[model samples]
Target: MELKKEFTDLEKSAVKLTVTVSQKDVAAAYAETLGTYVKQAQIPGFRKGHVPANILERKFGEGIKADTVSDIIDKALNEIFENDAEKANRPLPYAEPVMEKMPELDVAKDLSFSLTYDVYPKVDVKNFSGITIKEPQVTIGDKEIDEELKAVQERNAVVIDKKDDEKVEKDNIVTINYAELDENGNEIAGTKREDFVFTAGTDGTFYRIDDDVIGMKKGETKTITKTYAKDDKNESLAGTTKKISVTVTAIKIRNLPALDDELAQDVSEKYKTLDDLKKDIVKNMESAKARRIVEIKNNDLLSQLVEKNPFDIPSSMLNAELENRWYSMAQQFQTTPEQLEKMFSSAKQTKADILKEWAGASEKMLKSRIIVDNLIRARNISVTPEDVETRYKEIADRGGMSVDEVKKHYEDAKAKEYLIDDTKEQKLYDELYKEVKTVKGDAMSFADLFKGESN
Candidate 1:
């Protein structure tokens, strides 16, 4: 079908597309639709295939005209969108074109309608190179090594049953049966659990009972009333006060392994001696610290770049980003969006409030992404076949899998495309890093560095 197209730019990265279909096209579409109905449509008091054209038209003329008009519009729009010459008028991937006006179906005359949609903003990145960024200089000290060694020892520790007279203390694993009680001290239905275990005095334990668990001997029963804060992690119990009855059934203590050659052997076969384990720990810590430093530098550089180059983002893209972030947060909390919304309802928090709190970070992330993508395109950054092979080898070595196996895992087209894109981004970052002047700043401890803090 032949079509005449006109484009109009609207505010906020929106565009209006007006398309007119010729009368000849509409007539052709109507005839094609009519022929199909005549050939297959059933009618009373007549042979199915022998229905008269006038009768069919009289019975279904309006329906045929509407379907034909819709078909013509769809065909014209598809042609305009798919044509390479019309790429400039295409909407952004996240934006769906909505019909602004629906013209009445008219087979005898030309048909025209307008569609409005958001498009990606044209970005021109400036001042992206030669910027000064601070790089954290981190070193693995003995204190870090000792802490890591202690963690390792703890991991290999054995759990031993506590003595009969022993009381629960910090780091002791206690198994208990618990139930929520009403004001009358009656156990609430469906609120009981048996063999619930947690370590005393640890954040992993329930906030209401973490401190209360301390000094409780085995077989002891206690009931306490606690009020949970509004921001409690347990959404169901948040901002509610309840009485909980707890009975400690068992207590166990962790016996940490001695920091010696025997412990090293138990930790890993690669380490035959304590010094070997320490050396490996130091190497791993240094590598992790180096990676963290590069990550911080990259984030800082991108943040600066985004700040220098600002543009209005499409609302659709921002909404998509926010949705992804919201879903991710809900997943972390083991809840659904509906459940989270309901939980917030009690606290008088609206969806707008949540969006307002997260919009700043989400917008920053999108700005950084757009800037990096534009820079990569401007510089013609690409990943070579050798880059893919090298990446495959690296992944294979890390996963203890064959290179062919790793390649097989990424045989899907999308996986390969993602790998290529990731490689290109890395190359772009490396080039930009060279252009930036980085100064070594104050040294950071392992704890601070791994915790994602920068000087």
Candidate 2:
């Protein structure tokens, strides 16, 4: 096997490997196959296991050649990675090599095939000594607790329709009639609509609700106009201005429950009193705050790391990330893209549109992930069996299943892949933390961070 790398445009590297399998080696490989077949042979004129070598050759000769060829190709690839463990730095093989033009075997010569692959640009990571990041001191103050209690109350609140004479305000849900249009005042191809429900908050369902829906009262009818973003998931209505005439049919407001023993029971059975619930909330907030600080510091260090160690990412990897992102978003919304567009006819997306929108960010994310993986490997960080088992158990418990049952359910290939990927990310985070200069921040509370910034 002869291997060489050639530099190409755009900081890419192409590796060309030539593999030669001599006739002698091929014959030896075929001989073992012939021997096995001969032992089980049953020819027309001979007893089982008594077939002649020449006869067997004439019968199974082509089959032996095919098997030999497959074995050689598999062996070549295995040797390529085994020859140098550092092949991980190479751009992962984007496409399998084409071998239709490979050399054919002759009576006494060798057969050969050429293999090609692309390599990602090299990244030299350094200069970690002077790095400093502010760890957003987290504190659980009384005000934060009060705000959290308010949120909890809201979550447990029941919504009731307001009286016809009552005025509508923020946090109230309003029913309206809306339609989207083009610049020419002609109704946009996909924007015509009748009645729609919209909340007054920044929830994704109500696009630009703050500017259009808030401050309006029940029984009031009004026309509101706004520009929709070009990349808005709605393919037809995107980049268009539309008129919405809303006749508020009814208004509904949240009615928070009192913070007492009943509220405590509503939140969780583990707590018996309001104070007990508050203590539990505080404990959860503290843990969450600590985690947020760690996450923020980690992201800061990684962003700096990417800048210090620059390298080109493979287009294939970037494409994969884009697809993963789309799938993730789809899962979050609980529907496929096609279904989403059909359901939210005004705010659905085409596959091509989604790809175009996510391509740039996906590419950057792919490059960053590559850097994180390489750094973790270079530092010799490892996730142990115990770590994996502990995580698996925790996941099983959260999923409401026994660990043994979870293991059995994930005994297949796809589940193992998910487990390994999850474990690798966890292990990589630990490796990164060790490399950075960490200063313990103040004990922060989750309530402070969880509250809406403006609120």
Candidate 3:
């Protein structure tokens, strides 16, 4: 295992490791390899375990040399990495060392070879402390409470089916089969829907066909043309006029519960009065506001943190991330990655093209992840068993599950590890909140505050 090793720096956090094993070790290794092949050989003219070295070499010299060289390289790398004091020079897990070239083996001389691979980047976070971030100032008042209560009332509303001949009217539930039409009046593919139920005159339909559906009777079909504004929120329909064939199949009326003590009692067992329900709603909204503000804070500050700290991510890491995302997207479509690739192929594109398009976003994701990890390490943040127990209880309370159930759910080692890591990350966020200063941003309503986010 006697060898000389040298490292050469490369771009994108890459390193080239050049290794040289001495002539004595090479001779010994080659001899040992050839001896094993000679004993194992069963040449047609020779008995098993009795093949002559000269004959075996004549038949398998190239193969012996290749094996000897590969074995030497593996031994050298294992020796170097296992005993190395500096941890940062270790290759990234996803970065397999690629041999620069197969070395020319010579037993009489030293065996020399080289490998190039990526290592984790060294990061020095700057301007991350004492920074100012803005948080939106939002108030959850009677208007917000009323809006939420209206949704609650609708959820508890009673639905009465109308007669088959009844016409669609405002505030009545309508079920229709709809399809968009091309210029030739043919139904366009991927735009057909059936049994789409929505309340009329409430902007409930995705295509905004509420007004068009009014006055249409059951079993009635009509070709309706609707013009969408240039700045329409629905991107596909914006700035376009499309003809849709709508067939009314069913109609019904919704009778919403009145906002009173009875409705409050029906909504949940804890509330005895409508005012008590409103107070509970305010408390819940306040809790939601605090949680949403944390998200906004992260969007405001962590983005700045990522920008302030710049580091190169190894190409191997980036590629692995991109591949993970590709599979994730394929899973979202409920298709296998191979099938997804075929779909892209039909469009004259390859999986590589899609991966290339996602490289920038993936790189940012990796970079931010590395920065936060570095910060977490530097701060020496950790999660204790008590912290994990508290987190489990919190999850159980939120999910309406028992503490034992939550524990059982996270019983697997990987799940338990994830929970620990999650708790540590939350702790990191807590520390970050304490470290940074928050200023009031623009005042917005609850709806506006959560506009781009999922409810």
Best by TM-score: 1
Give all TM-scores, in the order shown. Answer: 0.81, 0.65, 0.73
The root-mean-square deviation over C-alpha atoms between each candidate and the true structure, in angstroms, is 4.4, 7.6, 5.1
**Candidate 1: worst 10 consecutive residues by lDDT?**
339-348
Tens digits of lDDT, candidate 3, 255-332: 899989999999888789999888878877887888798888876777778787766888889989999988997786
TM-score of the candidate numbered 2?
0.65
Q: Find the 10 residues in a row with the least total lDDT in model 3.
A: 340-349
Candidates sorted by lDDT, best first: 3, 1, 2
Please give the lDDT score for candidate 3.
0.84
Candidate 1's residue-wise lDDT over 1-455, tens digit each?
78899989887678899989988888788888888878987999888878887788999988877777788888898898899887767888889889977778777888899999987665778675557899877777889999999999988999999997899999898898887777789976545667878888886644358678789899999997788888977655578887889999999999998999999999888789999999888877776777688788888898888877777787898999888877776675456776656545544566667877778888888888888787887889988999999999977865557999999989999999999998898899889877778888777677987683532
Q: Return the clash pairs for model 3, or none.
A: none
What lDDT does candidate 1 reach at residue 90?
86
Clash list (residue pairs), candidate 1? none
lDDT of 2 by residue, 260-378 (tens): 99999988887799999988778767766766666677667777777776677655556666777767776655567455444344444466676887787666666667777676666
